[model samples]
Target: MSQKKPSKCKKKQTDEISLSKKRNTRAGNMGIGYETAADFAKRGANVIIACRNKDRAEAACEKIKKETHNQDIHYKLVDLSSFASVRKLAEEINQTEDHLDILVNNAGVYNVGNQLTEDGQQLLIQTNHYSPFLLTNLLLDLMKKSKSRIVNVSSLAGMAAKMDLEKLNKYNNFFTDYALSKLCNIMFTIELASRLKGTSVTTYSVHPGTVKTEIIRDSGLVAIVSRSIIRTLFKNATEGAQTSIYCAVENDLEPFSGEHFEDCHMVERYKSAQDVWIAKSVWAKSENVVQLR
Candidate 1:
């Protein structure tokens, strides 16, 4: 007997179903994290909102679910300031999820004064840089399995910051530390994209604009005054989340892999952010900081 041929329409439907099984994760609770999660949920994707506080995480998850009418949302506790906590969170995620379709490193801290994580790394650097690096490395296998996309929420501040790799951990000023951390984000994206060259996992860094987020929450009167003044010019968290969402789900970004994006458009970045030598140095030092090697 002659064998029946496969239907092209059936194959197309199967492909669509597999592509739509996108599992998304974002760090941070309020601000762009909440909005990003909601945006993904609205598109029929399962999301994981990883935050430092479980209660807030749960609340954000509920709020996102309610707003999007998508029930596939979950929350997990992750404290980027502590290496142990980051490891625990990554371990738990890897154990339960067979694949991680999208990861957005959206959480960041901008603090004044001298503060350090348990790893003896600067608080700003650890939260904004090292922790994300470690988490990405740990989840790389899962991301690879899913042929995923990684969106890192960086900033235009990175364009102006000058990084001194020698004294990177000796940070006290908020602006410099914040900018440096973001620069690191772009550099890491560049390096990771190179490393995953043959793999399906691709990475992109985003400049979410000068959005009104909780980054300055703990910075005293200065934080309040800045927020009030910038409130007039800067976009809100939902508006700021646009570029991140664009990078995460844009279907035709093959020619722009490892690029920095702003306002949902891919553009050239700063000289420092584009330096290959600097990117490699940051990658190697970050490995030592996180003991990845």
Candidate 2:
């Protein structure tokens, strides 16, 4: 057998091929998250990109407009890590749009070392749970009018969590903190669904799967790991975004509100996530924390 050495052009082409594949597979772009936004915009749905970074959100909106040829995509500034910012974003959305057809709670933070928000709550809990909770509540009326769908970008981590209602502001372990917040997300989704039972609006929680996004880089520890190593462990953002997209546009899912999803399929969540007592307590505490009651 003859031994062959890879050519430089072949290697370059292979790298680009892999890069393109990874980009196409990320959950942020692949699944219903961004792609659905593009589709909705193309179909004349006025889509808004709620994000903390105005520059990035505008760039994304521009790309969507250019690619989808839909100029209606807009951006709203929101910092999910801060309750005040979330409120401002919700107010802006409410003031501008008469009806919001879809609200995708896709913004998230992850795996960072101990950090706190402006309100003094743990950052992950505030960003991944409280902010979204408050925003959804603030915009509930608009959603009701539009018969909107709220898709919460939850995580598999929630299943591994147990909530301690008394200590929402404290977490003995970092990963546990993330997991618990995700659990809170699921509980909130179910409770919101119950509240909207007789209304036109619906809510759902989804696990976007392990995705390779800037979030991992944002984590001080994980950022040290070689890129190649992390790439082997996770799908790109689009693959992680699959469930959100499915829940957003799939007609079959319209009747499946308040459910938990993974990889575009509805699945039962952790039993604790469905406990009415826990849900109520969390809801009360959440409202108090956000001052939304």
> What is candidate 1's CA lDDT for residue 178?
87
Whole-model lDDT, candidate 1? Answer: 0.82
Q: Estimate candidate 2's alpha-carbon lDDT, on a 0 to 1 scale.
A: 0.70
State the lDDT of candidate 1 residue by residue for 1-293, as single tens digits: 13232121211121132235566665457998888887788777888888888889888888888888889999889889998888999999999887888899998888746887778988889999999999999999988887689998888889888877866798648888888999999999999999989898999999988888877886588887898987999888878887787777766565567888887777777887868889999999999999986
Off by over 4 Å in 2: 1-36, 218-230
* Pairs that clash in candidate 1: none
Give the CA lDDT, 0 to 100, for residue 102 in model 1.
Answer: 88
lDDT of 1 at 167: 61
**Backbone clashes (count) for model 2:** 12
TM-score of each: 0.91, 0.83
Query: How accurate locally is residue 26 in candidate 1, as Cα lDDT from 0 to 100?
Result: 59
